[model samples]
Target: MTTTAPVTTPKEKTGAETALADSWRVVVLNDPVNLMSYVVLVFRKVFGFDEATARRHMLEVHERGRSVVWRGVREQAEAYAYTLHEWHLTAILERNETD
Candidate 1:
Protein backbone atom coordinates (compact mmCIF):
# COMPACT_ATOMS: atom_id res chain seq x y z
CA MET A 1 0.00 0.00 0.00
CA THR A 2 1.03 3.57 -0.65
CA THR A 3 -0.06 6.89 0.80
CA THR A 4 -0.23 10.21 -1.00
CA ALA A 5 -0.16 13.67 0.53
CA PRO A 6 -2.87 16.17 -0.27
CA VAL A 7 -2.13 19.12 -2.52
CA THR A 8 -2.93 22.73 -1.66
CA THR A 9 -2.16 26.12 -3.13
CA PRO A 10 0.00 28.60 -1.21
CA LYS A 11 -2.01 31.54 0.07
CA GLU A 12 -0.69 35.09 0.10
CA LYS A 13 -0.20 36.69 3.44
CA THR A 14 -2.21 39.83 4.24
CA GLY A 15 -0.61 41.48 7.28
CA ALA A 16 3.01 41.84 8.33
CA GLU A 17 5.08 38.66 8.17
CA THR A 18 8.08 37.67 10.23
CA ALA A 19 11.69 37.73 9.05
CA LEU A 20 12.14 33.95 9.25
CA ALA A 21 10.05 31.26 7.65
CA ASP A 22 7.62 29.90 10.22
CA SER A 23 9.83 30.52 13.23
CA TRP A 24 9.34 32.42 16.48
CA ARG A 25 10.88 32.29 19.94
CA VAL A 26 9.18 31.92 23.28
CA VAL A 27 11.18 34.01 25.70
CA VAL A 28 11.04 33.79 29.49
CA LEU A 29 11.99 36.82 31.53
CA ASN A 30 13.80 36.88 34.86
CA ASP A 31 11.77 37.81 37.90
CA PRO A 32 12.27 38.09 41.62
CA VAL A 33 9.15 36.03 42.39
CA ASN A 34 10.10 32.54 41.26
CA LEU A 35 12.88 30.40 42.67
CA MET A 36 15.81 29.14 40.58
CA SER A 37 14.88 25.48 40.93
CA TYR A 38 11.26 26.35 40.25
CA VAL A 39 12.20 28.10 37.02
CA VAL A 40 14.11 25.01 35.90
CA LEU A 41 11.16 22.81 36.75
CA VAL A 42 8.84 25.16 34.86
CA PHE A 43 11.04 24.95 31.78
CA ARG A 44 11.08 21.16 32.00
CA LYS A 45 7.41 20.73 32.75
CA VAL A 46 6.03 23.43 30.46
CA PHE A 47 8.39 23.27 27.50
CA GLY A 48 9.44 19.59 27.86
CA PHE A 49 13.11 20.59 27.91
CA ASP A 50 15.38 18.17 29.75
CA GLU A 51 16.81 19.07 33.15
CA ALA A 52 20.22 20.18 31.87
CA THR A 53 18.89 22.33 29.05
CA ALA A 54 16.11 23.61 31.25
CA ARG A 55 18.57 24.59 33.93
CA ARG A 56 20.75 26.25 31.34
CA HIS A 57 17.89 28.35 29.97
CA MET A 58 16.73 29.10 33.49
CA LEU A 59 20.21 30.30 34.37
CA GLU A 60 20.29 32.47 31.28
CA VAL A 61 17.05 34.09 32.37
CA HIS A 62 18.49 34.46 35.85
CA GLU A 63 21.81 36.05 35.00
CA ARG A 64 20.51 37.75 31.94
CA GLY A 65 17.17 39.49 31.63
CA ARG A 66 15.54 36.77 29.53
CA SER A 67 16.04 33.58 27.54
CA VAL A 68 14.49 32.06 24.49
CA VAL A 69 12.85 28.92 25.79
CA TRP A 70 11.58 27.60 22.47
CA ARG A 71 11.59 28.42 18.77
CA GLY A 72 8.96 27.32 16.28
CA VAL A 73 5.91 28.59 14.43
CA ARG A 74 4.18 31.66 15.82
CA GLU A 75 1.10 29.71 16.93
CA GLN A 76 3.17 27.31 19.01
CA ALA A 77 5.30 30.14 20.34
CA GLU A 78 2.20 32.05 21.47
CA ALA A 79 0.76 28.93 23.02
CA TYR A 80 3.93 28.21 24.94
CA ALA A 81 4.13 31.82 26.07
CA TYR A 82 0.52 31.68 27.27
CA THR A 83 1.16 28.43 29.12
CA LEU A 84 4.20 29.92 30.82
CA HIS A 85 2.11 32.93 31.75
CA GLU A 86 -0.52 30.63 33.26
CA TRP A 87 2.25 29.01 35.26
CA HIS A 88 3.04 32.50 36.64
CA LEU A 89 6.14 32.92 34.52
CA THR A 90 6.99 35.97 32.43
CA ALA A 91 7.14 35.06 28.75
CA ILE A 92 6.77 36.59 25.30
CA LEU A 93 7.09 35.85 21.60
CA GLU A 94 9.83 37.17 19.34
CA ARG A 95 10.00 36.84 15.58
CA ASN A 96 13.10 35.09 14.29
CA GLU A 97 15.45 37.69 12.82
CA THR A 98 17.53 35.18 10.89
CA ASP A 99 15.65 33.23 8.30
Candidate 2:
Protein backbone atom coordinates (compact mmCIF):
# COMPACT_ATOMS: atom_id res chain seq x y z
CA MET A 1 0.00 0.00 0.00
CA THR A 2 1.19 3.50 -0.87
CA THR A 3 1.03 6.34 1.74
CA THR A 4 0.61 10.03 0.89
CA ALA A 5 1.91 12.96 2.98
CA PRO A 6 -0.54 15.56 4.27
CA VAL A 7 -0.74 18.79 2.29
CA THR A 8 0.03 22.12 3.97
CA THR A 9 -1.03 25.65 3.06
CA PRO A 10 0.44 29.00 4.02
CA LYS A 11 -1.85 31.42 5.71
CA GLU A 12 -2.35 34.90 4.26
CA LYS A 13 -2.29 38.00 6.40
CA THR A 14 -4.82 40.82 6.15
CA GLY A 15 -3.87 44.48 6.40
CA ALA A 16 -4.51 44.63 10.11
CA GLU A 17 -2.76 41.33 10.68
CA THR A 18 0.31 42.48 8.79
CA ALA A 19 0.32 45.76 10.64
CA LEU A 20 0.07 44.05 13.99
CA ALA A 21 2.84 41.65 13.02
CA ASP A 22 5.29 44.42 12.23
CA SER A 23 5.22 47.12 14.89
CA TRP A 24 7.05 50.46 14.72
CA ARG A 25 7.66 53.49 16.92
CA VAL A 26 7.80 57.23 16.23
CA VAL A 27 10.37 58.91 18.48
CA VAL A 28 10.90 62.63 19.00
CA LEU A 29 14.32 63.85 19.97
CA ASN A 30 15.03 66.96 21.98
CA ASP A 31 16.09 70.03 20.03
CA PRO A 32 17.14 73.52 21.08
CA VAL A 33 15.07 75.13 18.34
CA ASN A 34 11.67 74.06 19.64
CA LEU A 35 10.34 75.16 22.98
CA MET A 36 8.67 72.66 25.30
CA SER A 37 5.31 74.35 24.81
CA TYR A 38 5.71 74.18 21.07
CA VAL A 39 6.45 70.49 21.25
CA VAL A 40 3.35 70.01 23.33
CA LEU A 41 1.28 71.91 20.81
CA VAL A 42 2.64 69.85 17.97
CA PHE A 43 1.89 66.68 19.84
CA ARG A 44 -1.62 67.88 20.46
CA LYS A 45 -2.14 68.91 16.87
CA VAL A 46 -0.51 65.96 15.18
CA PHE A 47 -1.58 63.21 17.54
CA GLY A 48 -4.68 64.72 19.14
CA PHE A 49 -3.10 64.19 22.52
CA ASP A 50 -4.66 65.88 25.52
CA GLU A 51 -2.83 68.72 27.20
CA ALA A 52 -1.65 66.61 30.10
CA THR A 53 -0.51 63.81 27.82
CA ALA A 54 1.28 66.19 25.52
CA ARG A 55 3.02 67.82 28.44
CA ARG A 56 4.04 64.40 29.76
CA HIS A 57 5.69 63.48 26.47
CA MET A 58 7.29 66.89 26.17
CA LEU A 59 8.73 66.53 29.65
CA GLU A 60 10.04 63.10 28.76
CA VAL A 61 11.85 64.51 25.75
CA HIS A 62 13.22 67.36 27.81
CA GLU A 63 14.60 65.13 30.56
CA ARG A 64 15.44 61.99 28.59
CA GLY A 65 16.50 63.62 25.32
CA ARG A 66 14.01 61.49 23.42
CA SER A 67 10.39 60.43 23.68
CA VAL A 68 8.43 57.76 21.84
CA VAL A 69 5.47 59.78 20.71
CA TRP A 70 3.65 56.99 18.93
CA ARG A 71 3.75 53.27 18.28
CA GLY A 72 1.97 51.35 15.54
CA VAL A 73 2.46 50.09 12.00
CA ARG A 74 5.43 51.36 9.98
CA GLU A 75 3.29 53.51 7.69
CA GLN A 76 1.60 55.38 10.53
CA ALA A 77 4.84 55.73 12.45
CA GLU A 78 6.58 57.16 9.39
CA ALA A 79 3.73 59.59 8.84
CA TYR A 80 3.96 60.77 12.44
CA ALA A 81 7.72 61.18 12.15
CA TYR A 82 7.32 63.15 8.96
CA THR A 83 4.75 65.43 10.52
CA LEU A 84 7.00 66.05 13.50
CA HIS A 85 9.89 66.86 11.18
CA GLU A 86 7.66 69.27 9.29
CA TRP A 87 6.87 70.89 12.60
CA HIS A 88 10.65 71.32 13.10
CA LEU A 89 11.02 68.67 15.74
CA THR A 90 13.68 65.97 15.45
CA ALA A 91 11.89 62.69 14.88
CA ILE A 92 12.76 59.16 13.82
CA LEU A 93 11.26 55.73 13.32
CA GLU A 94 12.40 52.51 14.98
CA ARG A 95 11.15 48.96 14.80
CA ASN A 96 9.22 47.94 17.88
CA GLU A 97 10.86 44.72 19.00
CA THR A 98 8.81 44.30 22.13
CA ASP A 99 5.69 43.23 20.29
Best by TM-score: 2
Which clashing pairs does model 2 show? Answer: none
**Candidate 2 regions off by >4 Å?**
1-20
Q: Write the per-residue lDDT of candidate 2 for residues 1-99, one digit (tens) a residue.
A: 999998999988988777767899998998888888899999999999999999999999999999998999788888888888899999999888766
lDDT tens per residue, model 1, 5-98:
9899898774445336678988899899999999999888987889999999989999998998888889889989999999899998888875
lDDT of each: 0.87, 0.90
Instruction: For residue 85, give model 2's deviation from the true position in Å.
Output: 0.7
